[model samples]
Target chain A: MNLRRTTTATALLAAALASVAAPGWSDTLRLQGYYDYVDLQLGLQLPTVVVPGEPTPFGLFAENAGPGTADYPVLLLSGGNNMQIEGVSGCTSLELPQRTCALAPLVANWAHVLRFRFHLEPFSRGIVVFGAALTSEAVDTNPGNELQVVSIPIVAEAETRVAFVDVVPETLVDGRLAWTVRVDNDGPSAAISPFVYNASWAYGGLVDVQCTSNGTASCPDQMNYLGPGSGWNIRLVAPPLSVDNPEIQVGYGVQPQEASNAFDNDGVWLVYRDAFFRDGFE
Target chain B: MAAVEGLMRGPRGLASFARAFGAACGGPLPALAAMLILQCHATTAPWSFVVMVVLALPAWWRDDGARLSLVDASALAIALAFAVSGLGPGWRFDGANAVPVAGFVALVLLARHARQGDAARVVALLAVVALLQLVPALVAYTRTGDPSLALRDAAVPWLVVPNDLAWMACAWPWWIALARERAGATRIAIVALLALQLVAFVLFGSRIAIAAAAVGTGYALLRDARGRWIGAGALGLAAAATFALGKGVASLEARMELWRAAWSLFVANPVFGLGAHGFVAGYREWMPAIPVDPRVTPWPHSLPLELLAQWGVVGFVAVALALVASWRSARGRRGRYALAPVAIAFALVACVEASAMRLWVWMFAALLLAWPRLDEGQEGTEAP
Candidate 1:
């Protein structure tokens, strides 16, 4: 009787110690109901606003929140309009609209990250809604978490509409002849790396070249760029008011190589004589 | 004798004084701190956390000589779970379960020795806080002429998510119960406070909160003969309000996406959750493909989902056990009558909002478990 009691007590103590020592094992022992549930969760990260026809990169962040390991976890990426899969990383299949990644065996409390690159066809405007779903060997108790759906707004290609807006003559503090050459960016987007290149010129080169804009009192970085509905003014001191070269002809055009409305992109301004001439005796 | 007396006059005396002060203040402090936290939008201040630690200290000073009840055990388990989950790689003591765990501990200490009067004082204070919150809210409403905008503007320099204030106000039923026990001026005052809370609720315009309040208050009041009509009216009004605000289908969709993200987090670590504020960091990895702003909804929005996502299955079990224990402890006729509304209100709010990690919310839950029976005779007496 004494021996039996001792054995019983010793066994109970060992079991209790084991339960306390290994939490995972104890959890499994206590709740066998969820032993087979493989909760594979799939998520995707991509830029919400993307330029069409450009190679855009996105990533798949996958996790197996499981009490059970997922031996065959597959990621299904699809439901995107006008999206073409240019390249993929960590995925097995290259199928359009519905690409599958047969991930490695994902045990409980483990994660797998995969990346992909795709391009949206040009002229694809409005919103594009895409979805990704996860499937594994074991059952996901909550299907709501296993799938992710996201929307991206496709923005049209940025058009830099750079055009010359009338030049005005002004007298400087030193009584020097100056012309304010105004340029307007009547754009629906921003002017990237915009510049007033001297396409053609005559007589002496421009002196005291200072730039200003409506956005700021002075141009930011030599008028490197202009926002939509903004104006940039390049103030040039009139060349030395000489009789030998009576007219200062300045020709310039704004660039992006191409403009949505290129008609007024370049303008030629002829300052006959000088501000002294324009004042009365032209 | 001289040496002992000298020692008493020194640091030891100060220590004793502090302990006495902490013990004396512990019962009302949780309620007071919760009130301030709920009313004030800024929680980054260290005062609330300091109060929690001070309140919890007295539990270690003198033995209350009371055996640990199932409710007490479960509550302690919750704190332990929170603390344990906070451990591991890059574990910092700040920003996760620190305050909540301290809150749970202090709640346990408060419960061990709190009397009916203490409970009453806490409830009364909470009601007063609710009334005070109404003033600014009303002023904003008068200016904005829109309840939602009013609530938002009133909480200037401090962002008040509509759901947060609405969740806090879910305790209106408890205030109503307290008012029923009063007479004349006190009763009228409590009634007036409830009215203000109702107005504040309307101004806040959180559909989830409105629905939770309606369910909790309606259930509590509909049982009484005098309050039956009022309860029915309230239920009708709440239903109508929810329906009217049902145009927020986008909000609901956003919540669904948030829930999905939380679910993904849970699946990633099913047994031991990501630990306190883990979802805040991890959800980015599992963000839904939708063009949803993560900053707008930092929390999972669902308490159960958050628990699963952050604390994992272990934390979830601890909470489940605590709920069972609370139900058992408050199953008596009078206890049920007193505790049911608060419990129901909080539970309903928890279903749709991240109320679990909030210190005030935990304090309210503690109040639910610690509240004394109304028939225990006058205010200040300890339960036999």
Candidate 2:
């Protein structure tokens, strides 16, 4: 009985010690940071107008005349800022350039289509602009004498930059696990497809990669491209018989081809991995 | 002299066999037989099959002429029906399989023995069982490094969380009764065992269990004082204070959510429920789009609500009726040893932390069989 008791005591002591000395007994601590850029684009659509008769109206008038009518006299004209005119005026009687005109006119009993072009800068991040115009040059303005003004709204958002530092202990085997990390997204524009990859020493074979768009996935098999802010887990299995010190490294960058780095093309980003050991069976 | 001795010994082997057969053939025989059949289908363990066959042999042999009351018969019938249903549904023959069968057997045994005025022995057996449960619980707590959290998790795998608490609550009164009736060494052992169980219960950090212990202890004390009205008033005040102080507000909130889910299930299928273990599937079907994390299990964490959601009004009403009957029988002891535990069990169940079906059946069985026989009662009065 005494021998049995001694053996039991020794076994229990060994078991306890073994638990304290187990590998991968530490908690992985993580510190993450990211930088990103964004670009905005806008387009405009125009409306069309029609006339009832070939009779040339007052103010601005465009007409289609036979080649023989090259010397037609100008009847009315009007001009404005940021406007250009271009079209084939077959009226040789009209004293005008071949395909260019500025606030020109047309002869009576002639019909033609008028085209106008306006150039406005419409892309801004933190600012907005709105404006309008009127068309008094056309007679009876097809439906009615109308004031046509273009109101364009432009907005610009400022870009952002972020950075942080973290410290994680290595005594989690017999203690509570805790860590603190700093995160920043200094923004003129939101980072598109931002992500952070974290790897740890105890389970050094597998890497946990997470993105803003997708959840965690194992790493090193094939890079899972989560479109603009996604992440996935990446698993890495080591050889059956191998021994190495458990360590951690982290690397992160924007997803390729997802976002334009127009705002902060020359920016650097950093991510960190820290861990501690704890002595407990979970 | 040898001839005379032989005559006196007379047919010992045959008598023993006859007695064993009579006990086996009692009303519990069919239920035991059904349990064995179900166990055969449920477990893959060769040893369990052997054990079941061995246990059932006595019941099978004695099943013919053993007398049983109507209540015992009905209880057996209900248990058999449930076992058959569970077998049909393909519930695995494992740890989960043993819960209802063990509960049924315990009830049958308790009721049989209690009605014969063997209450002391029954109570003693229960105390021993409660003490035994403490070993694994302690081991789990120590190994996990978080005693309370470990107890909570262990409760699930063991199916003993709230049930163990109820058993402990019940054991307290039995210990007290034993100590009062049989003093000296027996009383000391009982007291020590009860104290140990109480310590383990407290360390478990089961809010409902702790509350039940407090209530049971207070009721026992009040019973000894013969201050039933004072006890009632104190209990009311305590409940009021708990509610006013918001001590149980979080649990109450969780109860309300479960109640809502139960109500919705009842509204959709007023009969037969969605099916056993069907509350989650049903909830998913009718659950409104709420912006919150999803729950994995269908158990609303409230026993009554879970019952209503899974079994519909019929099963719920039957269970409620059974509880009422058991509570009524226990209350006849007039807030004595049995009454306090019953009250504590009811309180825990009302808190929506534990199911009372198993405990209620067991308590009822004990009440029916263990109450003092009229002759014993008279003898006791004469002795005093």
Candidate 3:
């Protein structure tokens, strides 16, 4: 009995030592399953600009939040077959052995989540459904969590044109100054993220905005999108500027890599609103 | 003078210092040549730094002593040439190059301090490191059916290959030293360890490295005359099999085109060649039969051809001389064996990898095969 115990222990030790000796072996032994199955969850990342007829980048991210390793029984991306996976090289004789073709295979864990980005094809403007799912052969604990769909409503536009619509003077800085500058986006398509406008004053300048606000009420510096003809009143607060010119340079052209006409994109204006310093009063 | 003194001080005065320093510390050369064979990358690699500080630096700081014959003057010259070229048009230099050069220098410094018992210690230390690396490799394998199959994890390009190969090389001297000492169980363990590393490396699909390892392994077994014949025959068989199996066809065709391109570059400036690191520029102008719509690569993939093309015969001779010098230094039983991995890796690197661009590749021949150390009851027979 003693010898048997000793022998067993020795073999175990040898096996353990052997396992430990290999580079990546020890990490495997800690896993609970014989082999894990992936439980995949998918989501979408909207691009900077989603025009109705123009090409734009849109990404779909899949996460496997499971202890199990996942191999694709099926990976489906709905945009029909014309949507080419952007960076994928040509398929070899079974680069992935599991399926005839898969978006990606062996999506083991969250670390190796499968992602696909495509030039979102031009379809009729409406809520465009970009849906993706990964059905793993591995035992998924939450089977319902497999499929994900992101339906982004693509707003229909007239002939594509966006420009600085209107900049209205709201308030004047009294003591430690405060005022509201209304910036509007007139567009066939919405102005995304960076709404860059130039504010130049003649005598005393307005610089250093306190904060930006929209929808609710707060000081506005940045904006999400300028829905066609709808504008956000961005209030500006400043300490003081050396170039104290009271004139505010209204709206500049849309700052894109390439634009059709720069002249139509930008418009200039002078502040008609009275400031305490311009009035030379309290 | 101070630089020379620093390299030598780790051993003794110039001559003995040269001998002791040049002799193999083993691991770094092959590792640099091949890259990491899937292992605990962070852990296995960091041990070198620890070994440097603990083992090498103290001895060097005290002006310790030893003996030698190897040098990489040609490598140095080529690197200098490349550095000059890298500085061309603009200072377009490879930043990560210093890593390999540093790895090379570290091997030299460590070998200078090596003793008889140090082999066992290094082997043991490296076994741990290799095992740690293997842990990641295995986990990776388990998750993804193929072992070598992983996303492109290049914090640095081809960084992992040489480091792993060096660590893998570390096991060799230990294997030899252990065998020489007749340390039975330990030898088995080391063998098992190496097998594991090789399996992981293969699954990683670094086909070039796999070939290099095979070459290195053949050299390892070729200690005696009988073993030599066996090794040679096996290598020939491997070559024959590679062709017979049709595996070599694609590689051969690719290499032929690369060699042609390289040839074109060489013919253009036969003497001085295209002023070191000028292969790509030359390729664009010369544009030999491009296979797979071949774009300009830094290396033509074949080491000898690349050398011939870029540095001309002069640069090529410098490398050949360096190898010869290293061989001369690490001659005899273990020295020969130790140099095997270095030689094979270089040969493999020549055929496949851009090892010349990575100065550390040269360091293998420079550092692993020979080094200077005190005659501390250790025979200078063993190789890195």
Candidate 4:
């Protein structure tokens, strides 16, 4: 496998060297009054939409549609102010704030591609336009085909972390189970929509559900939008009978409308039950 | 010239037969090439390339080289510009790169062929290709029973999207006007074809397409001195209709933001500009908060601005020179006025869509470059 990889790399290097050494030759089959033509077409490939805080891969491609070589070709990088661009392979910085991916002379029917990855700002939203241009010393036959622009729509996003707090009962014989479910908006942005949660008991009815912020008042079925770094806690109480090994499950989920980047905390829950109280042993 | 004339006379048997066959097939050959381009599933457009090479074979054999006029030279320059834009960083090749070069080559061949043969017949054949786009629409309608779906989604898997389909519709009125002196039955058929095109234009719901049709048709009407008022009325009606049906100012606002972003890219490099890929990156930095259609993002959505933004002034000059030269070359031709509406509609639509790179656009350009001169006495009267 290593040998094959080495062979492929060697072939590519040789080709690149050959292209740099002899970029183009004047056409011998030119019709009368026809000057040598060099047509270069530029293209780009990237996902149209991207999530904030994630690396997005993109490629810029250029091809010489020529009867001659494109001389002194340079690929210029522009735009993407909302993104942190990285892994810009095969390019050199020619000017401050303007990185140019310079290439050797590109012969007829040959193409060059520059692949890179860009990460959107953690709290960024709206569209991000990435632009690359192919400029050469020679006048191109078709300029419209020489510049590529790719737009990536980076959506407004946030992350919500759910924490389960288990509290010891006052006494084992009390037959009481209590736990707290806390949700924090560990976000780059505010959650703009509601986060809905449900409290269900398998063998015992939910005795009481209280919002700690409201001093033991009933908790709403859904929590309103929370700003970045904000949190909410829901405390649940249930009673266990000796004959019944009761269990309590507090499930929660956030809709996509909540500015959430990922669904990691979606449709998740924690279960609580007391075995000693169920068996009447303590 | 003498050598070619002698060769033509000397070929008396099989070679003569082959030349005759080639000549017979030549008029419809470009249309066949276009059909291949439209039908090809892959972006490479390999089959169309083969057909173009084959279509140009007769012209090559005749050796009756057409003069490379200023218009042709400018067009070639534009093609070169397109080619050089593809020369970037790493050595690679793909369909996106190959198809455009092939398209430009096909444009050259078609121009040469049109200069030598009946240009009108080739156009009629193109009309035939356009009409054939409806077959799939019919099949879609049969399966789903929804005209909108048939026009928009159904044809996509098999042929063009609704926007391209609408672009094709822009040609109907011009073709109908060109065939005005035909027989009664043929005129009726042409009318029916025009109706179908209008239906496609309306049902496809491509705002750009509808506007293009309005402008193109309105222009044709306005040119006829007697119908000037009608043209004005038509434009007003179209505006009213758009407001009533469209998503209104919001969509227009989106396009405005996109154009502003593109203009910023153009200003950043007024000379060579950023290469094609500069728009997306530049747009984010310059106009980060603007909302735009994900489908139309990165593209200026306006052809002229896209050219300026990507290729800068040099690219704009190349295209402008070609347009002026083509206009000059096409002067004095019979029914040259018929081209006005088509050109107007095409330009207007391109202002809201990146249609400059489409194969059909190139084909239209080739036709214009090859448009017959008046002195040639080759104006066709056949109905489409």
Candidate 5:
């Protein structure tokens, strides 16, 4: 028994040495998953003006209330609202000739939030986040009343949060290969309805979308659209999934806008808000 | 006369003093010169610095105690020609990256001395220097497992063909020479080490290196034959086998791809091809868009193709003339020295695998020209 024990120890030592000598063999490996959150802001400003026969440079118009006297109402235009004539006052009835007058305000302010979501794969290295903010300028404002111009600063930020998970491989009795991947979104925000798709050799072959989100009956269907807010336990099958041979890609975004297809093999994508324009509505 | 006298007298007068001074400082001059030129142009200076440092020890060791040989003189002339031609109209000095040319000059001078038996000390010094590179390389490999592979990926990021090929071509000759010099237990040990390196090369999966080794070894083995009929018959059989199985070889397939690309470049600019460093920029104009790593530029990759793209047929002819001249001048065991040009020529042809063709070709040409004349009576003293 002692001899056998010695032999086993020697064999283990030799294996360790062999692994060290050979290239690309390692022990005590760690696979990490991460989630990145990004915040972005967009805004705009316009110049103020008044109307004469048209709108004036400062939105200040002169009107005779009574016999050569005039009055102007102080108007504050703010936040995405269009300019309009308020009212005329402060004139005697006999001093000035009767005149029809109006006051038009310039400049408007508007703000909206655009959210983009993405998931980090296990064991991936050096992932990067890229995005842009888009906006449009308004043309043809109210005559005599110019818009106040405000410089809109575009804001962008990215933060990476990492977590580790256990991967268990399984062989199905029906000659299929499958694996249950436990992906934890270590970030403050839950990964939300995350589903693994477009699996490749890098990610250990084809992975079919399996049941997720608390194992409910609707989990598989709903998990296809992920990122509501929770870690995902997904099971995937292979072979048939290898036809398109698509690369492994995970995507997420805010309400209304769904994540687009993975940009490329590197799993990169860009997101931004659509442009806004003013019609005739007040 | 005064200047010459001063040179002979001032701290430089003593042979030992001059030798020590040169040892201490002369080795870095080429790199320093390169750095200055690079700095003047406002290009990246670090690459030039690294390349210069890499070339310095080899250059110094080669030139230390040696005299200029015919081969060295000819190489120097060629390098000078390139440098001069580079200064011509349409060639912007700022971007030409003249350090490689400068390094070529240093190597030529070193080769001349090596031919004269004056470079023994330099060779010894260089052996130490080359050995030092093994430290970091080995450490990196130990940490990451494959240093060269990692470096190649980090540096180039996209194509793997040329980097692997150039490394194999550069090291194979040295390995063969080292193997030839060893005996018994030591020989076995050396061979084992060489095998490990070769295995590493294979792991790089470079088709170019594998093919170059096969062709180079075949040429070496076929240099001499007992009878014309037997030799002819053997050649015919070999040719048939090669034709039948060449495509099965991955290296050959890669070479064919490179050749096709090169041929296209030649056809497009049959005249004075693209400008220096122009091939990478021009690849998009000629080739279809392939998903390429953002880090790697589209370089022609083959030496001949690079020449054809950059210098046109004229530059190619100049290179050919230089190679032929060196080949004709080499004497003694012509077969062995012949390997120098053949290796270089094959490497040039295989440029799609590496960017060292110009450097290797010039180095081989210098060695060829500086090869000690058999009549010089120093033949017996030549170190392996």
Candidate 6:
């Protein structure tokens, strides 16, 4: 047993060592922007939400993680949208010129992490540059800090997010379970082919499936909506003796509508049996 | 029954599947809980983990000596409240709490059969996973010039972030309180782990998490009236700091409006809540603070308020009973007292973050119920 512990410890140490070994890789510095910083628990970042006309000065943060002092910071822009760098230390170009004049190198200094500050920017779609190259004009001995580029992929995320609002299945007095499900768009654009089903009951043929949209059972295609709360409502009567805790799924994948990340494509629920009384095992 | 009937025709029958499924889930739940605590991929990870636990239900039911404990009974009570609430108009019958409740029960049962050294080993194993989480982020940062790589491809394979590291840091009060129990490598590992958590908190900029850690640490360090004072002070400081960290006056205003909405919802349906997942609509429809367009926000952003709004008084009472029972168990028992501070920190985190339905929160909560007061020498692994 001690040997096993030692061996496991040894493996972990090796993995940790391996992870930090490539200290001077070209990607040593992190180039952070506005959209790059948005971290959501159940959501993904897509570039489709940049609104034009507003002077939305996007954020740009150059983080230094290398062993030595790095300098020279530059901001590059491409893509049809005109963007400007505001209140940045090294940006001397004042928003024009692909490469900005280098200010006194930020000591090329950073402590492995930094947070981005939000600002106004004239909305546009294209690329922004970051990294060690932006830090200094001199050749960085550490190639690890190379110039990096990113694009806020132009998307209509407002339309993509669709989710199963609720999937409540109740046990009836007759021992049969009654299920109701609702879908919500919660995004900017309307959903085209919104589909909702009991993912757990994959063997659809075995179960006697009866479902409806807007109380109309057997609508050829499920309901679609252009805004929040506009999607379809489904009522289901599950086959007798279905298993407890079934997983129900909802998503929109018909034409003109795409899922918002994988999240919009799938919302799941765990259906419990009528678990009110004692020994409510279900 | 059908699967059992088919299996009963054979010799081992269902017990065999229970043991097999139990083995598969037992090893990963703690590690996954650790992930759920710290990462944005929390929802996905727990959903996947619960599938494993749910599959093992047959085992939990058939396994002798695994009857419902105080924790289970109270958990069921809370669930029944949600059931009762479902009979109303607003409350939902999603049984969202069942995942965490049942998962906790399964884990406790698994621990009962653990060997003498399993408790220490379990801690060690979970600690290793916590440390290993850095690899993907570090490697991703190196390969791509993005520090938030942990958020993007961070949980690609693991179904999970640095905040997760902070979430794992929530356990430090327990470790720091118990660190002296070991010497040499174990001690060194404990210290290193705590330092890493501190560093992660500083770098992550998750003010709420840092405050939660401070609560846990302060409690562990003081452990008495002074500690309680320090915790209250920390809570006050956290509230101030969190409010300060707000984007501007709008966020504070929004928070006030949000709080008011939560209160109003609770007042309106003080008996039961709008439902388990009713906050999305409640926030949009009733919340006068926001513009228009009422979308989904999942929970009420505060765990206690979420409970009041979702399951209403019954859930609150059940949760309160479970907490008191666990506290009593921790105090009455020897080694378990150390978990109190950590649990308190979890409660504090709920104030800033929504986690009533989070599997990781409940997993640790349940694990604390089953935790041994001391692993050095114990009669058995079961809770007293």
Report the lDDT tens digits of candidate 6 across residue range A105-194: 343335222222222232222333222233333221221223445445323333333234344556578755555554445544334444
| TM-score of candidate 1 versus the correct structure, residues matched by position | 0.51
True contacts kept of each: 0.00, 0.00, 0.00, 0.00, 0.00, 0.00
**Docking class of predicted structure 1:** incorrect
The per-candidate TM-score of the B chain, in the order shown, comes to 0.78, 0.64, 0.65, 0.79, 0.60, 0.69
Point out the higher-scoring one by TM-score: 1 or 2: 1
lDDT computed for candidate 2: 0.37
lDDT of 4 by residue, A186-240 (tens): 6655565555556446465555666785564554454455656876776666675
Q: Please state the CAPRI-style docking class of candidate 6.
A: incorrect
Candidate 5 chain A worst ten-residue window by lDDT: A27-36
- Candidate 3 matches the true fold with a TM-score of 0.45
Residues B227-323 of candidate 4: C-alpha lDDT, one tens digit per residue: 6797777677777655656666666777788888879877877765566444543554556453654332434668888777766777788888878
lDDT of 2 by residue, A15-128 (tens): 223223321111000000000000001112332211111111222233322111212232221223322223234223322222223322332234434333322221212212
**TM-score for candidate 4 (chain B):** 0.79
Model 4 chain B: ten consecutive residues of lowest lDDT: B88-97
lDDT of 3 by residue, A1-282 (tens): 343223223322332333234433212211211122234666666654345434455555556655345444445556533233442321222222232224445345553333334543333344556665555532211121356666665543322232322333334545434444444554544444433554533345545443343455432334454455555544444433223544443332233112321223433444433443545454
Over B202-286, each residue of candidate 3 has an lDDT whose tens digit, in order, gives 5554455455554665675676554677667645654554344444456566666767888887776666566544565456455
DockQ for every prediction shown: 0.02, 0.01, 0.01, 0.02, 0.01, 0.01
Q: Which structure is stronger by lDDT: 2 or 5?
A: 2
> Least accurate stretch of 10 residues (summed lDDT) in model 2 chain A?
A28-37
Screening candidate 1 with a backbone cut-off below 3 angstroms (N, C-alpha, C), the clashing residue pairs are A65-B267, A65-B268, A149-B290, A150-B289, A150-B290, A151-B290
Q: What ranking of all candidate models by lDDT puts the best one first?
A: 1, 4, 6, 3, 2, 5
Clashes of 4: 47
lDDT of each: 0.58, 0.37, 0.45, 0.56, 0.36, 0.47
Displacement of the residue A220 alpha carbon in candidate 4, Å: 37
How much is B39 displaced in model 6, in angstroms?
11
Tens-digit lDDT track for model 5 on A137-176?
A: 1101101112233422211111122121223235577644
Write the residue-wise lDDT of candidate 6 on B1-384 in tens digits. Answer: 444454665666676655555554444334334433333332233334334334433433334552445654554465466566664456443333344444444444444333344455556655665566655555555576544454455542221223334456567665654455578888998888877755555554456567777777676656555456765665566567545555355534555566667777888788777766565446545676443323224445577887787777877887798777666555545442356666677777667553454544555665665564223244322223
Minimal lDDT window, size 10, model 3 chain B: B150-159
